[model samples]
Structure formats: structure tokens, C-alpha cells
Target: MDADETGRPARQLVVWRPDQVPAQHDVPGPGDLRDGTTTGRLLIRSLMRAQLGLSLMCLAVALTVTASFPVIAAMVPAVGRITVAGLPLTLVVLGFALYPVLFAVGWFYHRQARQLETRFTELVDPPRPEDPAAGRPGPDV
Candidate 1:
């Protein structure tokens, strides 16, 4: 059979090797985090501040939503008079509508908190670079 029909053809494989080694940088390592060096302490304080800011933001949103309900009822009396399924609209909002809003706030907070922690972890303990010589054929071959 022709090489084309057989779905096989001769081809040379090529290997790439780097001519120069990568330059090393003095990036913070896990030891720096554990040893509480000045850099490590600064990193920890920054993380704490970020988390605190996130928490305060979430709390502000929650409090605003909660407090606005009474103000809205008082300011717009028609809203309080409205009803659905034989239930007062305010009751419906308090019983069902507010839950989803609060839940969404909580979900957002959790997702953002996880992302912050993941970024911090990557900074402290970075993945190692693969060895250039590994799994390659030796020069003797």
C-alpha cells in the first residue's frame, strides 16, 4: 500500500533545548510566610485588611436592604396595602423575597472570599517549574 493509503509517513522528530537558564528572582516563599519576616508580616496584614474590607462591604449591603424595608413602607403607603395570594405584600417580601436577596449577598461574599484566599496561597507557595532535562533522551542516545 502507498504511504498515503496506509496513513503512515516518515518524519523526523525534533527536540528543543533552552540555550540559557532562567533568571532567579527573590520572590517571597512559604518560609517567608511562616517565619513572619517583615515582608511576610506585611503580606499577612494586607490580606487581613482585604478580608475586613470585604466583610464590611457585605455587612453594609445587608444592613441597607434590611433597614430600607420599613422606610419604604412608611414612605409609600400603597406598597403596604398591596396583597398577593391573600398575603400582604410586605409580608410576602419579608417572608420570601428578602431570603433570595440575602442568599445572593452571602453567595457573592463566599465566592469573593475564596478567590482572595486562593490568590494569597499562590503568592506564598508557587508551583515549581518542571526540570528542563527531565523525560528527555540523554546525549548518549
Candidate 2:
């Protein structure tokens, strides 16, 4: 079998070029976190606000859907007596309709959370250029 100079099997070795070396400025320093710049504070506040808003919206939807059942039952007793496919209307609505509303709330919450996280990530860590020599052999050491 073919072997390299060290008698090991011929395999590619990465040789980083001068330009490939990461610059010191590219890395975040301790002060970047501790400084609490206006932009950083703004991002933090924005994230908190977004999370709070989403939570409140989900809570409102859940509360409204859940509370409506008892209110309707009390205000209009006849509604409870109504039947659909041999099942009481209240039963069908409570058992089946509620599930879709809950599922919809959950789906909306998940989608909003993901979008918020993506925005936060992009803001905190700007995308860098792809490495040209990634997964490929470079000049010999």
C-alpha cells in the first residue's frame, strides 16, 4: 500500500495559509459582553419584549377559547342540549374543537419562537464568509 513520509497511509493534511489564519479582532473579547453597549442592550430588550408578547398572545387565545365554553353553557343552557351526530354539541366542541385550537396555539407559538431565535442569532453572530479551504487539502506544511 502507498505510504506517506511518516510511513502512514497517504491521507490529506490541512495546511492553513496566512490569510486563513483568523484575525484577533474577529474574536469577541470579555469587554464586548461587559461593556453593555446600546446595541447590545437594545437586542436584549427586543428579545425580552418579543418573548413576552408571544406568551401573552398565546395565553389570551387559550383563555378566550377555554372560558367561552362555561360562559356559553351558563348563558344559554339550550346550547348544551344541542346534538351533532348523536353527540352533545358541547361534548363535540369541547373534546374536538378545543384540540384544534390548542394545536393551532402551539403551532403559532413554535413558529414565532423559532423566528425570534433566528433573528437573535443573526443579530448576535453575524454570518462569516465560507472558508475556501474547508474540507480540502492546502499547501504542504
Candidate 3:
């Protein structure tokens, strides 16, 4: 502490020596997005493309499955007329099979979405080495 011209004690200044400070990489500032760098845009585009692709794949699968019913009915009239548990085969497939197929598609979509989110999180905010449990297995429940 040093005395000022007014005789009041001056605050102490703390300084860090060069060797005491950890080295740091050049991280982008908050203004990087407005600075027209393509990194942010590219990441957004990649994520959008992945989502679109997944949506298209699910759409294609749903279309194929739904269209198959009509195609099968037309190509093989006997299949539609066949009885299953006192109900027409077509009615049975339409009533029972569609729900399971839809449920499966929903489950697959949820899993894929979670995976995509995990990958995105890894890209945006990578795990830190200082974290003790980063890659460690948890105890059994």
C-alpha cells in the first residue's frame, strides 16, 4: 500500500507473472458471428442438412410402407381377401401393423435426434480434461 497525495492509503495492485499464467489458444470473440466468418454459418448449414436428411429418410420409409398396402392389394387380390382371426388380412395389417411401424419410426427418430444433438454438443462445447468423470463409467444402479 502506498499513500496518495491526499494522505489516503492507495489500493494494492496484484500482478501475475508470465510463467504463472496458463497458455491459452485464440478463441473467437462473441463478435465473430457478426464479422462474417463462415464457421457459424457452416455449422448451422451442416446441422440443418443432417436434420433434413433424417426427415427425408423417415418420409421415404413411411411412404414406402404406406404405398405397399395398396400395391399389394392390387397385385395380389387373394392376399387382401384372406381371413386372419375373422378379419380380412388387409384390415388386420392396416389396423395392427401400422401402429407398430409408426411406433418404431418414432423411436428411431428420437434415437437419431438424440445422437445428432450429442454430436452437436460435442462440436460446440467439447469435454474438458479437468472434468474427473468425463469418460468414466458410472456405478451400477
Candidate 4:
């Protein structure tokens, strides 16, 4: 070890154990998520796939509901000619009836999407037990 003008050995500032082995295959933690480790990427990809599937399913339902009206009206010519409350049947169905169906689809999609996100958040950062001392009031003067 190098030393100052004096011939004494320099003091060691740091030390490491050569016998200690690094951790292997430990459970991924929040650090892994922030560090973008392999397991973190897999978890994220799974969540994205779930969200995408939900989106596609919702889109399919909305498209089917919207398209069915035209197909029904075409297949049954009498439906187009009918009137409801001084409005054409098509107008009543498209303007009034369709709104509820679309609204339900949208609501369902929103609820499911939120649930998926909540699940993902839970997976990434599982809830921890509250510290007993945290809630206790500190000693007063």
C-alpha cells in the first residue's frame, strides 16, 4: 500500500469479502421494475397484453352493436318504414336505444380496464403490513 512521506502503510478506506457470493435467482422486487430487469419486462408485457385484449373485445362489441342496426333495417324492410312517437323507427333506435347500449359497453370497458390496472399495480408493489409504530403518537413534552 502506498503511504505519505512517512514509511508507514496507508490506511485502507474500504474493504470487501472475497468469500461472499452474489445473490442468485432472488425474487424480483420494485428495484427490478425500475431497473427494467427481465422479469420486470415480462410482467409489463403481460399487463399490456391483457389491456390490449380488453380493448379489442370492447371494440368488437361496439362495432357489432353499431353494425347490427343497418343489417337489421336492411333485412327487414318494414322496420325502416315504421314510426315511433312521430319519429322514424331508425331514428328512435339509433338516437335513443343505441345510446344505452353504447354507454353500457363504455362503462364496462372502463371498469374492466381499471381492474386490470389495479391488479398490475398490486403485482408490481404488493401491499405491505403497516408499521406498528407509525400510527402511535410520539411522546409529548
Candidate 2 residues 36-126, lDDT tens each? 5555455577789999999899989998988888998999999889999999997898778889889889888987887776666555544
lDDT tens readout by residue for model 1, 92-113: 9988998998988998998888
Sorted by TM-score (best first), the order is 4, 1, 2, 3
Give the per-residue lDDT of model 4 (tens digit) for 1-141: 569788888867554321242322376545565667787677788889999999999999999988988889899999899999889998888778989988899899988887887667666655543434322332332
Candidate 2 has a TM-score of 0.64
Clash total of candidate 2: 0
| lDDT ranking, high to low | 1, 4, 2, 3
What TM-score would candidate 3 get against the native?
0.64
Q: Estimate each model's TM-score.
A: 0.67, 0.64, 0.64, 0.67
The model with the greater lDDT, 2 or 3, is 2
- Which candidate number has the best lDDT? 1
lDDT of all predictions: 0.74, 0.69, 0.67, 0.73
Candidate 3: tens digits of C-alpha lDDT, residues 1-141? 577788887877667332343323344322323343566556667778998899889878988887788988899888878999898887888878788888788778777876786676566445545566543333322
> How does candidate 2 score on lDDT?
0.69
Pick out the ten consecutive residues of candidate 1 with the lowest summed lDDT: 16-25
> How displaced is residue 49 in candidate 3, in Å?
0.8
